[model samples]
Target chain A: MIEVFFQYDFLRYSLFTGLLIGLLAPLIGVFIVVRRLSLMADALSHITLTGIAFSLLLGRHINFFAGMNPVYMGMIFAVSGSVMIEKLRHTYRFYKELAIPIILSAGIGIGVVFISLADGFTTDLFSYLFGSVVAISRTDFIVVLLLTSVVAILLFLFYKELFFLSFDEEQAVISGIPRRSLHLMFIVIVAVVIGLSMQIVGILLVSALMTLPVAAAMRLAGSFKQMFLYAVIIGEVSVLSGLFTAFHMDLAPGGMIVVINVVILLFVLAFTSKK
Target chain B: MQTNNPSHILEMDNVHFSYAHQPVLEDINMKVSPGSFLGLVGPNGSGKSTLMKLLLGLLTADRGDVKLFGEPVKSFKQWSKVGFVSQKANSFNSGFPATVFEVVSMGMYGKVGLFRFLKKHHKQKVREAIAQVGMEEYMYQNIGKLSGGQQQRVFIARALVSEPDLLILDEPTVGVDAQSVTNFYEMLKELNVHKGITLILVTHDIGAMSDYVTDVACLNKCIHFHGNKETFEANREEMMTAMYGHDVSVIEHNHAHDHHDHSHDHDDLAGTRS
Candidate 1:
């Protein structure tokens, strides 16, 4: 495996991308889970699929779009979808979770329309849907690195504000935290992370990467800080092991990674339930 | 046309609030002096929480002026001087993964501002706040594992961590046990009398809080009575009956000693009122 990574640039790129996504996913996931916004991630990932599919369809006709990275379009759509979800949540205040399914269904519905319009699925689309370890280009790797750095910096800057908001939103607002702007910025970041993660975990399983590690950590962690630390550790372990297994077995990395996350979660559940 | 009075910690004048066109608070005027423990007692749906929210600038009043620490609430940027613990604080998710220390430290985040880390002095303040509430032993303990009363104390510590000049609690003892509730009031009294933190405690059970609060205000969509504790005690029955919109018998009990028999007295009061 070490020799393979040294020889193959694609393998090295995938490994680096996988590690970055691993760190980013659960770092954001802790806030999502604690705020009961787990399904928002799933909804945002589906919307990212809409963006990717729309870009693919546009590329078929437009010469300018043909050379553009589909991930950029995916991010734009994801951020828009996040904002729409926030608006919808306010529109249906009593039924805030209703925003998730509404956006999710719209996303998949529009995504399928674009896919069909583009003359059905291709090999490229298949690689994106299930995640291909060898398909990650150098450009994709750089993009992932840039996004991960941006996310890390933002999280570090607003760590206390985010934690306070997640713990008690009403009190945080009362304490003079700019609740509306922070909420909008947080959701936009979540959407962008989902967009970038599609290459590593695929759209369908992206939310699992964000949620599963945090779920396992929550069962065992004594404090929020511990939960955050354990979640990142769990995420890194799952990604690294999943990549190795996928390379040896010729399986989809996304499926393998999510499976490992599930295994860890189940193991934690079993361990904690006894006490 | 009212001037900002430097002596009042909170002042609301000609305040009118309506929810979806239904009036909640109307033509309300009240002032809370510095270092006064004011107990805001009202029946359910009497706009007590709304009034508190308006004072905290969480909810905008439909019409009127609200001043905090001699500044208009809209322009008041010194939020560190005002701390609020909502009624919902007691009913928060128990599974929230936070220790007492972490929860208390959050109170200082506002004062620390954006793009800055909490310094060593902030940590010391957090420790001091936890000690003030006598939760030093539970500093590292998960907030969820503690009892309701203990959790309430931790929240109080969180509020005190910032060392606010004014502290407002909305039904902080909702699910607290009898003995713990007594201790909670005593701790609050100590904060008010000794620490000189002005308090506005919102509760429906005026009888329970009468011994601790320096003043009492009864609300029913408006300020029915706002006076010193002596005047409130003198007019307790008349005020209770008027604010509740029915006949209510006031049963005076010292919360510290007779809390066990307090429920029986409540049952008797209910029987008479009905």
Candidate 2:
């Protein structure tokens, strides 16, 4: 683990990026989970797959200008796709499952078209699909860092209002918190975190990182502050352990991290529920 | 009943609102002075909370105007001038994790800003609000661990943390224990007598109105009765008959008014600087 930390800068960058994601993913996850928007995060992450594929299919061109960092295009598509999802969910009179079909089919449709066009499905596209330790570029590292700072600063500045809204949007608004502004801010933050974390954890595994630590922490912490602290700590531990295990086993870092989170959750639930 | 003073804290002029073309509240013309405790009594879905929502600028009125402290409600930017504790439906009980102190301190969000980096003065104000609500013992305890009444008290503390001229509580006593209900009213009465904060108490508790509320407004999709405590005391039968529209029952539990003479030091928020 120490050797993995010291020998290569990419791994160091990966570790730092992982830690940043560790704190933020779960922090935002608390809102998604509370607002009963848990599935929206899932839908949003899968939508990132479309962007990931497009960045790669058009990878030969976009990367010609800015290197192989897929995040810029990834974020653009993620935010746009999320906006679409919002529109679909809001506009359609059908069930929320209807929005899922629209977003899911659109994401999968775009992803399939891009992947088939790229002709790099099995071998070259594994980084975007699974997780790639080698793909954590310096630019990706910087993007992750910038995104982490933005998410953290937003959360800190709006902690009380966010808490009130997450707990009770109706009451928070009645107390004069800007309802539309706060809700939009939360959605944008969720998109940014999911997009950046996709480089390391893959879109498939990121929401688990975002949500699991919070679920586990809620069972143990006596207050909301402690829950937040414990969630960050647990997120850090999962990311670090997963990165180290992936290095040793020659496995994908995202899968390893999610596994570590699941193990931690199981242990915590068993311990706390026993008490 | 001489209407001499033009210094009403809250006023609604012919307010009209509807949901999907169905009228909910129409022509709500009421004026409340500073330091008066007006209780909104109504059956379920009678627009009690909706009127409070209008007061706080949550729901826009379809027509008419809402004025806060003589200024238009829409024009009042700094919400700290009006403290509000919404109904208990907003409370987080299933998976809530907040200490009483943290939850109460959240009330100061408007005044102290969103961040928790409070100065000493802000800290003292938070503590004072918590103590005012008789929640000092559980200040450090997790809010989810407390009883329903204790949680409501924490919310009241939070609302008061900003210390506005008008404090609006939407059914603050419902679902709480009987002992806590009386205790909650006592605390409210103390705040009214000492701080002279204009209060709007929305509840269904008919018997407890005289003890805490200076005025009562019974709502049944419309204003069945809007008048003073003395009038309610005088026309109990008529008011109940109008409220229920039939042979409505009233278990006249006597609530003493003698305990409202307590003293304290407060003008409540910055708007009531007298």
Candidate 3:
């Protein structure tokens, strides 16, 4: 692993970025898991793909024609899509589950449209669908860093509110936690995290990164704080090891990271599960 | 009835609520004075729980007003000041990582507000609250690991942690062991007497309510009766007759009346120890 890190600047960036995501991903993953919104993470991640493909299609157009970073546009689109899912879910009370499929299909629909419209920009959609850790650019790293900060800061600032809400939503409501606002903000934060993570873990397995560690941790932890600690430890180790092996074997790091999480999940399930 | 009796903590005026236009509560009216233990009792589907929701603003009243501390319940900003324990005390995030202490700490969220974390005093409050419910032994235990009785106590502890002016508990003793139910009411009585916190307990067991509550309100989609404990005992036959919809449990009521035989004795019921 040290050798891999010392070998190439890209590898170093891969490990650095991977380590940071390992910490932040699972930290947020704990909240996502507790709130039972792990599936929403998957839906939002895929939605981000449409935004990413559009960014790819219009990178040159953005720089020369539009005078904007495609990343910024992509972020806006991804965040907006996340916000839309929240609105749709909330606005349609009787059809709460409908939001996921609607967002999922809309994303795929937009991706298909953008792919057709892009003409010749990055035809290898499989890479984005799955994951390629090496695909993370310097700009992508910056975005991930900013995203990690946003997630960490917001999570810290709203720690009590989110914890109370996630544990017992009705109690939180009775306590006047501004359920509507925090709920909207939660979806947006999830979108931002999913957007950045899609580059490495890919849309396909990003939710796994968000869910598996927390599930495993629940078996061992006695309280919310302990569960978070356990999840962070599990998540960080899995991603760092996966990133290293993926680099050495010349494979996609994101897929490897998720596979690593699944394998550990299985290990924990076998040992800890009562049934 | 007591020295700690302050102004009314809750006042409901012609409160009417329904689900999908099917009436669950009809023209309900009640008031819970501070430092009093009021039991909202009725059979199943009698809207005891619904009345609690209306008081907490958890459910909207379609045709009346629920005021908290003389203000509209909807406009109550200091919600944590009125603690709540829904009937489904165990129906929370069972898999979430949180101890009895943490769950109780969350009860302070309203008073602590956003951006402000729990300070040392908050920790002390949590510690005191958990101990108040006789759950200090399980302070660090995961809430999911506790039995039904223990879980209910933890919820009570969570409610108490807020140091509320009023505590509203809906069927909180359900699913708990018999001993726990007795213990829980005793704790509530202590809080109402010693700490001077108003407690509104919603339960189907009017008999159990008689054990501790200072006042009683019977409901069957509406208030069958609402007044002081002496009035409840004085009208025991009516409460029994009204609740059973004829007369089946009259023996138990007679037994209690005969056993206490102190309806007019004032101090006997008021100072009865659990």
Whole-model lDDT per candidate:
0.89, 0.77, 0.78
Candidates ranked, most accurate by TM-score first: 1, 3, 2
What are the per-residue Cα lDDT tens digits for candidate 1 across B105-156? 9999999999999999999999999999999999999999999999999999
Tell me the TM-score of model 3.
0.91
| Model number 3 iRMSD | 1.2
Model 3, clash count? 4
* DockQ list for all candidates: 0.77, 0.45, 0.78
In the range A1-275, model 3's lDDT, one tens digit per residue, is 57857577766666677777778878888888888788788778777777767776676466663443344554566688878888788889898878888988898789778877877455346667666756666676776788788789999999899998888888888888999899888878877776666666766787788888888888878778888898999989888888777767877777788788888888888988765
State the lDDT of candidate 2 residue by residue for A1-275, as single tens digits: 56867689988888788778888888887777667777778778877888877877775656572455666677777788777777777788577557867886788788888888877557645666666666776787887888789888998888778887877666577566777777778888888888877777887787888888988888888887788888889988988888888888899988998899999999999999877
Q: Count backbone overlaps in model 1.
A: 0
The lDDT of model 2 is 0.77
lDDT of 3 by residue, B233-259 (tens): 788787768776875465476446534
The pairs that clash in candidate 3 are A223-B97, A223-B98, A224-B97, A224-B98
User: What TM value does model 2 have?
Assistant: 0.90
Better candidate by DockQ, 2 or 3: 3
What are the RMSD figures for all models against the true structure?
4.9, 4.8, 3.4
